[model samples]
Target: MYANTPRTTATRHRDRMSYDRDLVHSVLDEAWVCHLSFVVDGEPRVLPTLHVRIGDVLYVHGSTGSRPLRSAQPDGIKVSVAVTLLDGLVLARSQFHHSANYRSVVAHGTATVVTDPAEKSAVLTAIAEKIAVGRAADTRPPTPKELAQTSVLALPLVEVAAKMRTGGVSDDPEDYALPHWAGVLPLRVVAGDPEPDKGVEGVPDYLRAVIGVTG
Candidate 1:
């Protein structure tokens, strides 16, 4: 369980906030993209990137020359990261009550450079597997030159909280009888049929499984 720090505590809709460690992990795992925000030269910067979780640590990789990666040099830099997955669109009878159903996690911590070769390799493998099961085994491992060009940063999940809104619409009792459609429009990320490259012949079973396609 994660202690609710002042930073992680919600200032609004507190009921939707969760401190459960499992909930946090699930939210992070389900969401492929994360928005990483940090300060560079006294200016705030945020960018979307892919992230993978290993235990309590969240790892993000990018070119070695990237601003954020370079900032986490010898000493780590403070950063805020957020991952959100939209579940549905709530359409209330009244416009004011309309909102989105989503699961999101916000974490605050220091983003430190991952320098260990073994750990870096594991992080890379985990990222590939996250994108598609068995992908790491199917593709060639990153060469030494490639590894030298990429940089990875690790953020520990210490001060983190998950906030989510689920279920149908929440409209005023008086507006319930209004002449308007009011309900949740469920949303999800669906994978489409894989289109292999010209030389590629067949789709891997593992890839099909990842996308929920049965034989």
Candidate 2:
């Protein structure tokens, strides 16, 4: 479990905050995109990009020319990254009590550009595999030229906390008697049928498993 420091402590909705490393990892791993917030010349900027977690480090990548990638230099850049997954929409008798069930993680740290060739390659592979379980092995590895054009930043999962809300709606006893529909509308990501290119043949086994297509 990660120890909560002043910066990591929850100031609001304290009951929803979690310091469990596994919880934090699950939330991060399940998310396809993460919002990265950082300052550039005293101005704030936020960019949404792909991310993958390998052990205790979170890796995000973009073109070498991207502003955020360029800013994370030798000394590293201070950043706040967030990942969230919405589970359901909570409907209450009263609008005031309405809320959504979600799992989220916010991390604060210095993000530094990954320079090692092997590590950079591995990270890129992990990001690809995150999209489809066994994709990295099926696709060609990035060439030296391709690797040079991409920039990856690594942020340690130190100052991180996961916040979540689950279960049914919570309404005042009086509000429950109101004449209105009240219940949770469950939400989840469902994988659609795989569409292959014109020249390609049958779906790969890995992809079939991902979308739950059985013979």
Candidate 3:
């Protein structure tokens, strides 16, 4: 079955949209950042931030005073979240036919601040691991003061939609005879060389694993 109402129907490109649980979860899991849209005082704002998914919940952390997080508190607040991973560029012979090959996920839902310190801390660990495999254990835990200023908000994995496009250029039949060349340009994210700090003894094993480096 499909997800909630808002995600069930696609006004455009219905064939490219899906509500499959596995597809939605995979998109969210593979994405490192998301654009969250929330309204405050009759105005809408979107902010890009890091997030991590644990089971059916997605957690985003930031300062307690942040506008978006503050608005999403005990009372709960509805927001829109979008995550996209651009895989390639479809270069058609004609400009109008140029398109992008990408996987995107969108969802509308309520988000709320996580009040339980223990749960919040645990969420932080999961988020850290998402950034770098074993990053959570390598750094100092959040202190009381730090935790006080921080806010970890959660959004349920409901009302979600995943849309994706993949293939070569979709050129017009007439364009096939044209001299212009057309093809797909594939792209992907990659890790950069490790930059060790002066005080650090050496690169940690976790860093090595993430960067494909060995000491």
TM-score of each: 0.94, 0.94, 0.90
Local lDDT at 88 for model 1 = 90
Tens-digit lDDT string for candidate 2 (58-159): 998755355656756688989899999999999999999899999999999999988887888999899878878898888999998878767888999999
Question: CA lDDT of each candidate?
Answer: 0.85, 0.87, 0.80
Please identify which of the two predictions, 1 or 3, would achieve the higher lDDT against the true structure.
1
Provide the clashing-pair count of each candidate structure.
0, 0, 0
For lDDT, the strongest prediction is 2
lDDT (Cα, tens digit) per residue for candidate 3, span 1-215: 34547545778888998888888888888888888888878998788887778888888764534565775668788878899999999999999999999999887888888888777778878877876788988888987676766677788887788889998888889998889989999988777667888886777777767663211
Give the least accurate 10-residue stretch of model 1, judged by summed lDDT: 206-215
**lDDT score at residue 26, model 2, on the 0-100 scale:** 93
Candidate 1 C-alpha lDDT tens digits along 1-215: 89899999888999999999999999998888898888888988888888899999998765534665675676898989999999999999999999999999999999898877778888889988887878899988987776766688899999999999998888998998889998999888877778999999888987887664211
Q: Model 2 reaches what TM-score against the true structure?
A: 0.94
Instruction: Candidate 1: give its CA RMSD in angstroms.
Output: 2.2
